[model samples]
Target: MANVLIIGAGGVGQVVAHKCAQVPEVFEKITLASRTKSKCDKIAEMLPRKIDTAQVDADHVGEMVALIEKVKPDMVINVALPYQDLHIMDACLETGVHYLDTANYEPPEEAKFEYKWQWAYHEKFEKAGLMALLGSGFDPGVTSVFTAYAKKHHFDRIKTLDILDCNAGDHGLPFATNFNPEINIREITANGRYWENGEWVTTKPMEEKRVFDFPEGIGEKDIYLLYHEELESLSKHLPEIERARFWMTFSPNYLKHLEVLQNVGMTSIEPIEFQGQEIAPIQFLKALLPDPASLGPLTKGKTCIGNIIRGSKDGQEKIYYVYNICDHQECYKEVQSQAISYTTGVPAMIGAKMMLEGKWMKPGVWNMEQMDPDPFMADLNQYGLPWQETWLDKPFR
Candidate 1:
């Protein structure tokens, strides 16, 4: 049993709190803190076990360090914004506590996602005799683990990888992001990029489109190729990968609204002079949109995310697909969150469990794939996000 401190009180944080509470043998105590104390209190009230709540600005290293020192948690689970990753990591280092996050660091000014920033702290963590786990969320989390499992058991050489993420869930709102709005809009408006022949190929945002026949009767939907952070890490770690790409399905209505927002400059991240003050257009736009957490009750349908791997096994060509299907309504019933939060948060709790149990713990920064996938895979079945694997005659595309 361990005492864990969770930063960030968004939708993902709520799920993590609930899931952590469910496993008392692992997490004997939990502290859910955020910038807003009320949000933390709200989540604490919903959990079956007693969880402490506090207020801390995740972006401030000193604040986080003070909280860590006060709580004396064995580990810190950071579900805060991508920009705050380094700050929390620094706090963990100062306090000699293990660290884990679902997403990598992205600068507030620039819309970029990569593990380089976090990877640079390898020496710091190793010297401190602490561990930092990056990209433990669904795509970067379970998807990365899935590939590692494939390498261990299925493939001799992985040649191509297509990470298909489809969120067919409907929130019954015209324009609402499933996650954080600022992060969502910044990522969508950025360039589309993929790795091929040991080089990156860039295209216009959402330039590549295709129709994919998803598993478990989700049917065919249009998917757009975009630059996802996982591709960078996978390409680096799995050097044998010849080509890699990421695709996501977007609703027509969402696309239409995004197009209009882009045309009118509502999606711009650059600060503009407004009422004698500087404000980012996208941040202002986020204020107008529905809170992603509130959409859990209204969201319906499912999300299917997986990887289509084409490679050689036993000196013979082969293809395989591993995926997880999550229902939005079902997730809400269990955790009062949609599949988006549930998918990301469940793995986060599991990742912390892996560290606390000494299964994947080490004195350095690491990605999900760098660790063993078998134990993590087993826990997925034991937890909510159960996965399935099937052999494909050929690639889905």
Candidate 2:
């Protein structure tokens, strides 16, 4: 039995709290915290098992340290904003508690996502005898594990990897995001990037597009290339990779709305004087948009996300596709969240469980691929997200 503290009361946090509570043998105590204590209380009320709730300013290391000391949690599951990642890591380091987060760190002033800031903590965590697991969410989380599993069980050398993420869920809203609107818009509006032949290639956002027929009757959707945090770690860990790219599907209506928002500068992260006060346009727009957590009851359809790897095994070239399809209604019925949050939160809980159970315990900063995928893969199936694999004679990219 172990105590776990989750710092985020969003949709993902709700799912993580529920999943962790499901496994009582591993998580004896659970605490949900956020800047707003009421949000934590709302999630805690839905949990079958009792959990503690607190208000914490995750942006302040001292505040987090105080909470960590009070809760005395074995580890901290950070589903908070990407900007707060460093602050939480600092608190974990000071308190000697383990750390895990879904996304990488991004400065609040700049719309950039990279692992360099987190990777800098490698020596600090090692010296402190603490463990920090980065990018344990669906894309960087499950995709990383799928690649590692393929390498261990099927492939000799993985030369090419295409990470395809498709969300067919419809919330019936004409222009709304599946996750945090500010974060989601910033990521999609940025330039697209991919790794090839040992260097990064940049392209205009949504410049490259393709159509793929997703398995299990998900059908074909238009997917666009984007720069994901996983490409960086996957390239470093899986050195044999020659080419790597990430893709996600978007509807034309969504694209149109985004283009209009960008043209009018609503998507801009820059601060502007509004009624003699400086405010970020994107943040203000986010306040006007619907909360992603509320989309659960209205969302329907499914999501397909996986990795397609091509390389040689046993002296012959081969290709494999591994992916999971999650339904929005099903996730809502189980945990009151859409598949996007469900996909991410499920892995966050599993990663934390692995650490607490000593299945992935180590003293250093690491990515999901650095750990053994066996336990994680098994938990994925046992949890809400079940995945399948297929052998392809030709590459999808």
* Per-model TM values vs. the true structure: 0.99, 0.99
- Model 1 clashes, total count: 0
Clashing pairs in 1: none
- lDDT for each of the candidates? 0.94, 0.94
lDDT of 1 by residue, 1-397 (tens): 9999999999999999999999999999999999999999999999997999999998899999999999999999999999999999999999989999999999999998888999999999999999999998998899999999999999999999999999999887889999999999999999999999999999999889999988788999999999999899999999899999999999899999999999999999999999999999999999999999999999999999999999998899999999999999999999999999999999999999999999998999999999999999999999999999999886756
Worst 10 residues of 2 by lDDT: 388-397
- TM-score, structure 2 vs. true: 0.99
lDDT per residue (tens digit) for residues 206-320 in model 2? 9999999998788999999999999999999888899999999999999999999899999999999999999999999899899999999999899999999999899999999
* Candidate 2 residue pairs that clash: none
RMSD of 1: 0.7
Instruction: State the lDDT at 115 in candidate 2.
Output: 94
Return model 2's CA RMSD, one decimal: 0.7
